[model samples]
Target chain A: MELTIERATKLQTKPNWSDLTFGTTFTDHMFVMDYEVGKGWYDARIMPYQDLPLSPAAVVLHYGQTVFEGLKAYKDDAEEIFLFRPDENMKRMNDSCERLCMPTFDGQFVIEAMKQLIEIEQDWVPEVDGMALYIRPVMYATEAHLGVSPSKQYRFIILLSPVGSYYAEGINPVKIAVESQFVRAVKGGTGAAKTAGNYAAALKAQEVAEKEGYSQVLWLDGREQKYIEEVGAMNVFFKIDGKIVTPELNGSILPGITRKSVLQLLRHWEMDVEERRLSIDELLEAAKNGTLEEAFGTGTAAVISPIGELFYKGEKTVINNNEIGPVAKKIYDTITGIQSGDVEDPFGWRVQVI
Target chain B: MELTIERATKLQTKPNWSDLTFGTTFTDHMFVMDYEVGKGWYDARIMPYQDLPLSPAAVVLHYGQTVFEGLKAYKDDAEEIFLFRPDENMKRMNDSCERLCMPTFDGQFVIEAMKQLIEIEQDWVPEVDGMALYIRPVMYATEAHLGVSPSKQYRFIILLSPVGSYYAEGINPVKIAVESQFVRAVKGGTGAAKTAGNYAAALKAQEVAEKEGYSQVLWLDGREQKYIEEVGAMNVFFKIDGKIVTPELNGSILPGITRKSVLQLLRHWEMDVEERRLSIDELLEAAKNGTLEEAFGTGTAAVISPIGELFYKGEKTVINNNEIGPVAKKIYDTITGIQSGDVEDPFGWRVQVI
Candidate 1:
């Protein structure tokens, strides 16, 4: 495949990385490709990050025919930039495209494009503790048609943003509200795909969670609303009776990369890990009996967010001393270390960007 | 509430009404309003049809936090342009905004803004047979944030498109495909909201249906996958034993305006219209026993798309002589007549735009 790179005419000099916030700032350039009906994805290039000249009838503007993926780039003390298991994000994005009826792109081609974009925008990567360059690859329907059908033409673009830690005040435990009225994903829904619609559906519930003084919403199963599915943007795992118990991938919850890595590391360390449908009753009972020692959420951004208290309706349940559990801290540290190139990547997960 | 109106600086000559197509061409002016965290919604105006300056990190770009509502403006022989049940669209749009976490605008406010926009672009309203001005009201998260939480800002805009009948030749029977592997909406999800995510999620399965030589996909229940939910973009209705039977509003199916109107009409006609869970087995049984008289889909774009053949897995079922069914024609005629001011507004559904 041939590629073209057009540098931005104007580039930011001496970016104030210390004042960076998540997704507020962007680099000078971006990656874009177009896909037509008969022709597949073509005209792939890296160009200046600017506004897209979209038609008023673009499918994404009306039908929300779009999908996206999120990953991060970490810089080590040795001045090396590495991406943690970016291939997972690439594969997940393709999966999302497939579910959304958008054409899928080659994982390797997408990875190569990301590597080039990251290399060009390396200066924008923040150099603070737990701060990294947030990479977003998006696929959208660009066709100027009004029909309720899949878009024939699509646009694929990758943008980069530098940001601080997810919580900003270090990895502190967060209070979460369980919204019984609103549900995130259903069994046969697009929950497994990292599609935009899934996140969009959760926003109102997140508002309710925030109004209740919680950081996120703990989403339950759509059917019975009795089983714990996941947190807002992360996967839930519980340490119960010396065994790692996490909700199985039942087609409604996103299989987080961090969740997978932790499971792998735990299995490699010969720890008990079980993936099954975990119910709220079982968890509360375990917590009451002292079998549930720690509960946390894992994802690309937060790494691991400890659960201090879960506000189920109006009642609150405290968990494991209301602090970052030792297990979660160890996993978070190991994953960050490997991504930042401080520790040896035994799984060969990190890919060098520059 | 205070209101501000900026008239369009540029206007175009009206196009031929007979040449209108669904969502192809827009009117001269559009309504736009911006929102920020503390300031709320501001800069409301009716400006010329143009592109919006959106940042690359806009929440809708990545997370799909968008929702939209569709209605039409009809011009009677007296040159009166009226909107059909716009308050329904307004309520649905706000419901969608609540679901997508976009800022909300009042029903009367949006209706008034749309009235002004349509008034400015009134020349674009089509006078030809089965042609009208298609109005699209969209709300999205405009915040330049990449976080998964609810956005602190939003943008609401309404665009107008002059459209002809969906099927210019006439309402012909359409072949349908049953999507067993894919589902449209799930219980406790955003299926009821007029949000963009639900439509985005349905595109893939609809594409598969089209590829299989079907006009639309007949969505099934997300959990059981045995019950009938809806068609590609419209609400499905079945007539059995001289009674209209449609799927109940189960939080997973879009509660369409046309569907509600059909129900009201049926009830007013002293005909039984049942809204309950409908199973595929029941439909197949009815089809086999010659009891399933007809089937059709209802929406604003496609008033009634009659279903002739339903391809389920490998089995096929033919419905009602493969023609526009009597019930469908009656519902369509009544609804269209009321909309176009040809019949008495018994329900007071039509609201004059100008």
Candidate 2:
């Protein structure tokens, strides 16, 4: 588990904390490892953030054999950094790697490397209440070939970016367009894996939604385009008649880490929760019947993005009068509180890195 | 569309023609261009073959917003080079770019650039009877951002590889597995585009088929898994009861240039060809009745590959007595003859580069 270290000779000036943006400014260093077919994973090192010299014929650039994971490092008032459910992200990353046919590594070793990386760049963790250092771990096929197969060479990298809140409006409920035109992923596709292709498949629909004045798109099942799958890059949840309901992980929905935590928190509080096939028709009916109490999206970027409006087939459904519902607010507060070390850790989900 | 040229100072030794492989060796130079949101496509140049310096957060690596086109440059006995329907490849590449939200350029300009690139490395074009220089043009998002949206910057690159026949066995019929479990693309998915994600999604199935002693997989439709869509990155055609049949372009199958050329050639030869849905059940039924005369796959890489046998659900269907059928042989010979200047170019599909 020994890691090589290389310090930067010159460091760039950090961005103003008040004006930080997502994924734009990065820390001084990054962690990297490479894997060859016969050599396995080797050359683990934490070096200064630099451009990767890649072949023009690299498989990742041509076939999209890449996977990534996203999580954030939080700093509380005590100035200690914590990672929320990083082990879960590591496990999910391995799952994504397996789906993409890339090599998998020991999650614990990688987590330890991430901890060292975070320790060295501790100052980059923003002090703002809602802001944290965004950590991105990515793996891609590096084989310089044109064949449509798994790569024999691979590279895994971890980069850190100083960030602001995901939503520019700061957790205000967002308008979502229920997309029925473009399908994201099918049942037998790579949807369940956090692979690059699923996100690429989603860009067009997201663009259309944004053009229509919606912040994100609500994706339905690829087969029928009827059942709700996810909202944008997050797992979606709806509160109907005092019960929390989310679409079950049916091999096409990404098993989000935040979604898992929210469900756990709800179950711990003894709330009625159900994970099942939730259809858009049923949701619209509930909205019409005044039983759709709350709706929100959960992800690493935006812990809980309350959905204020849903546009489906030229019809709009306003939920909770365009306000954050009580349930969403509670879930958001409890999760963020635990992440920032302000609230008691009942679930013990937070891992201290620094 | 003026393209600047930069010659390489040192070139690597060319691989022996006898030992040539697919997509591994490279030429002395490559074509490259860049695109910015408002600046449009610019900086077109032919430069020495070298590694591309990419950022860790490049959108293509994380989101898979990449597309590519494959064509080949053939050398005739008279020392002249020809490109088979390269204009079609350019047009399809633009279609792919539009689908991925990347900027599209004039097809003519890109084709001219490709020609110049080919002329610069004309010696790299193999003179072997079955060998040619494989040309690959790729476009990918280069914007270093973490959000799941279209990239504001992109890179378009073209690299050349001198290779032998796609099948090391020299166009011999090979075994294929009918995949019912894993789906490649659906109607609303990115199946029609020569994008990176679609190929990424097909790798697992291809791997499984390879493990089952098959060279490729016959992918069915994503929804029902009933109808045939494609075969191992190629458009498939079947000769059922002496009629040439292929899956229609229903937005879920890549409109292969080789496939189109073959259809036109068949029509010119006064053969009955139909573009319609051909289900596996019907194909198996035809096999049982001894009406399935031939089955072949068409693509840029493998111009025509004969399917010797199909394994589906533990049942094997041997086509044309596990040999290259008459129709497939004629089609392959006609196409290759036209490409290599051994046959009349009545279809005007050949573009003379030098």
Candidate 3:
């Protein structure tokens, strides 16, 4: 796929990298492509970052037929830009499109286009200690119709935002509330796909958790509300009785690349890890027995977010005495080290963009 | 509550009334308003029908933080426009907004604004049998942020489209497929809200039903998948053993305006109507016992769609000899007649716009 580039006549001054927030300040350019029913993906171009002109009757606005992917581009000490596991994100994005009845494109071709777009806006990659250029790729139905069917027309766009560290103060552990109501996804639902509706369905529960003095929600299974599914937008893990356990992908949990890497790293170091159904009762029992060693969440945004406390049914259990455990610290350091090119990448996860 | 009117300088030629499809052609003007956290709802205006300029990172694009309402404006023999219970739609739209954590607006003020918009585009209300101007009111988050929270900025816009009859050939019965796998809405989900995500979640199942030679899918309960919840986007009704029965106002079913009208009409005529849980097994048993008289769906678009045949788990049950039953025909005529000003609306359900 050949990509045409158009430079912007003017550019906005970059913000202070250290004081930046996530997904607010954008770069100078964006990449866009369109898809029609008869014609596949066409007219891939890089243009000035601007507002999109859309009809009020667009299918995406009324039916939520849209999917998105999030990743980051980091700059090493030598000013080289690199992307961590973008191919995995692309593949997952296709999975989301299939669930939403939207068309999918070649992942390799889009990854190549993403690389070209990142090269053009490489200056936007922050050079701070924990800051990086957050990349957002979105695909939505642009058909100007009101029917409840798959849209015949689609638009795929890539945007770049310079983001600060997820935890500005440091990698502090957060408190999570165990949600007993308002499920995010079910077995036959669009839970595994990173679609907009899944996130939309999660906002209400998240709001309730926030009002109750919690940072995120620990979602239970939709049917029984017994098994632990996910924690806010991340995959959760618990170290109980010297065994690392995470919930199996039961068609309702997002398959996080960071979660996969964490598991791989654990196994590489000869640690016992198991992926199966982990019930909330079992976890609370382990906490009561004082065998729950460590609990953390893994995702692209914050590589490792330690869960210091869990509040369920008016009961709060503090984990690791409200501090980051040794296992979480090591995993965070290893992942961040590999990402910044400070540690040896034995897994070949990072791909250089420039 | 003041609405500023800005007429289009150049209006496009109106499409042929007979050639129009639902929500495909727009009028010359549209209604728009904005909402801010502290400012409330303001900047109400009627301007030329045009494209909306949206940011690439708009909250509605990434997260499904949007709600919408669908109603219609009818034209009588005097060329006057009428709206069928628009106040109820505005009220329900507010309910949907509350569920999605979006702000609510005054229903009376929006109803007045809708009236003004409809009056300005009175010519767009087609003067044909079973044809009217479809009104779409949508509210969505406009904040350009990636965080999972309610947006501080929102846009509420109303667009009008002249639509042909839902049954262009005639008011014929349609076959429906019982969906035993995919669930539409669970008890704590957003099924009661007229939100975009709910509709997006049903598209895949609808596609599968269509491919199986069915007009729509009859959704069962999300938890047990035993009791019937809804049919496509409409609330369903059944006449069994000389009783008119429809599903109760469960949390996972849309409380359709037309469904309400149908119940009221049945009560007015002294018919035995019941709003309670009707299980699929009970319905199939009634069919087997030759006590199932009629089955139909109620909504704003089709008004009343009779169910001729139901396919469930590889078994087919034909109803009323695969034709429009007497009770369904009467209900459809009564609702359509009341809407078109041909019958007396004793319940004061019609609102005159002009």
Candidate 4:
């Protein structure tokens, strides 16, 4: 029930943030905890990041009983780091564990531990204009069994990586291909849960879209293949006739944190917004009628990613003449500004760690 | 590539045959190989079975980019081991790789390496009447990056487990519940592939069924939730009006190896069999008309698991007076007989080792 810290013997020299690839570099220390069925979670420790000595038959390797969360820590000009809505991420992680039949941990306890970790690794935070310290929390089954049931043992780990800017270049609109061959998730599947198998099942579709010269794939509903589900790993929004429109939180779609923030901001500003089922046919028709004004994706990694073109079933529809629209740009600037402590924290979403 | 063998300095004590669990007990050695993007698969070796040193950011531990296969090695009275349909398992493993966007390997080469592993762990095979050694072949992404895409590195492993007899208390009919809430898989999803996420997704439903006094949960179609899909990870079969019927391979159903063998055996014996769409309504109607005869599930773990009762929304249907039928008995006996070399294997499915 007590947290312990064991420092590394030696630290490696830090690399230039601009030249580093996204999520490939890490800090010196990581937080780890173990859990058993009757024993609950215990032995919390901050240790040096190194190879994990796992059993050859660990359940996560063969059964995919794993869950993960992604967020970032941004530094203001005065050298203080803030994490946005860390509580929401922890709650969502518990939801994922319940869906996967795993155990749940205390949210406040983990947030406090994360703060301790951030305080120790304060110097690792990037000073670059667009970069941040990426936080990755992962929990997986460590039971060395070949049975296809819920595991009795588990390991929870929180890793820190000094990531490069998601938009190294300017925030340009990207080309997306509407996928009809593969479905990302179904209503009765693990789509709403941030588990590993959903992403693994989507790699083939993404690979095919990449080969066809598309930046990402826009998935439709698995049952009907009509309603829009997600664009790549992020939630999508479309502006039609000066109204912001996004798909509702159905069972098959992930509830993105950025997507929720955008909705809250839109409602606070008294802007027109609609959350309902938006089909691909309806979207394409709106484009033909000149009502489809803007399109973009929202997620933690990029914050806001504009969509310049969409190709589906041998049909092409360009939006806003292949440029970032005013609404999208405004939302991006506001959200990022709030994260870096440059704007008013009306919602009080950001929590200072150091 | 050539396979190098590194024997362990101190061998582990062989576990008691009857006391060992199904898959927790393992032999002394294992086979491993590596794969990278530019370079093909290399560094094949048969080494001691121990802990696997893995990176904290390995793609498989987080993203679930993994595939696997299962089979058993049976020993006859003459001290010779028989591997039934190893080639089929190897080919299916490659199919699983293609579906998950992972790299494929030489099936023949892996099979040969497995034979060598079996030879080295010959003494570990159980001599019990129904006991055998289970072979698990697993492939998973090993790249140490946090990107949600296809990994650049992977590892393939083969492990042998000395398992106890599944029918230690004699084969008994199991009660199954028809699941309407949580569907196992949907069409155009990763249902057909032997991937880990699919199993992880089904655990919640299985756990609920077990608590309600059911041995397994029978899955329905995701789109309509009417037609039958699978029964607790195994393919299902029904006997109505003297005809053997099963759900067709409609992309959402796993192409089970044991299911194929059953169909072949039924056809070889000139029995009536049908592979088509079978809705739950039609099946329930058959049960009401006093024509429903038998039902069973097929898989590598249990060659033929008979179903005695089926539970649906406030309705219960009993089959064959809650007993195994004549046809089900014949199929199980024939399959087990062929596997143990007591009956003629006309299909040449049994490959010899040692």
Error of 2 at A296 (Å): 1.0
Best by lDDT: 4
Q: Which stretches of candidate 1 lie over 4 Å from their true place?
A: A1-3, A6-18, A166-170, A313-315, B1-20
Q: Give the range where candidate 2 chain A is weakest over 10 consecutive residues by summed lDDT.
A: A163-172
Each candidate structure's TM-score, on Cα atoms with residue i matched to residue i, is 0.93, 0.98, 0.98, 0.99
Question: Which of the CAPRI classes, incorrect, acceptable, medium or high, describes model 3?
Answer: medium
For every model in order, the fraction of real contacts preserved is: 0.70, 0.82, 0.74, 0.80
Q: Report the Cα lDDT for candidate 3.
A: 0.91
Q: What is the Cα-based lDDT of residue B68 in candidate 4? A: 97
lDDT tens digits, residue span A21-133, model 3: 77888899999999999999999999999998988899999999999999999999999988998999999999889889999999898888888888988888988767889
- For model 2, state the Cα shift of residue B159 in Å: 0.3
- Candidate of highest TM-score: 4
Writing each residue's lDDT as its tens digit, candidate 2 over B191-279 gives 99999899888898898889889999999998889999999999999999989999999998999999899999899889999999989
Error of 3 at B115 (Å): 0.6
**Candidate 3 on B27-126: residue-level lDDT in tens?**
9999999999988899999999999999988999899899999999999888878999999999999999888999999899889999999998888999
Off by over 4 Å in 2: A167-170, B167-170
Score chain B of candidate 3 by TM-score. Answer: 0.99
Predicted candidate 2: interface RMSD?
0.8
Error of 2 at A193 (Å): 0.7
Clashes of 1: 0
Per-residue lDDT over A1-354 for candidate 2, one digit per residue giving the tens place of the 0 to 100 score: 579999888888878887876788889999999999999889999999989999999999999999999999999898999998899989999998887788999999999999999999998998888899999999999999987779999999999998987655656899999998888899889999999899888888888888889999999998899999999999999999999999999988999999999999999999999999999999999999999999999998889999999999889999999999898999988998998888999778989997
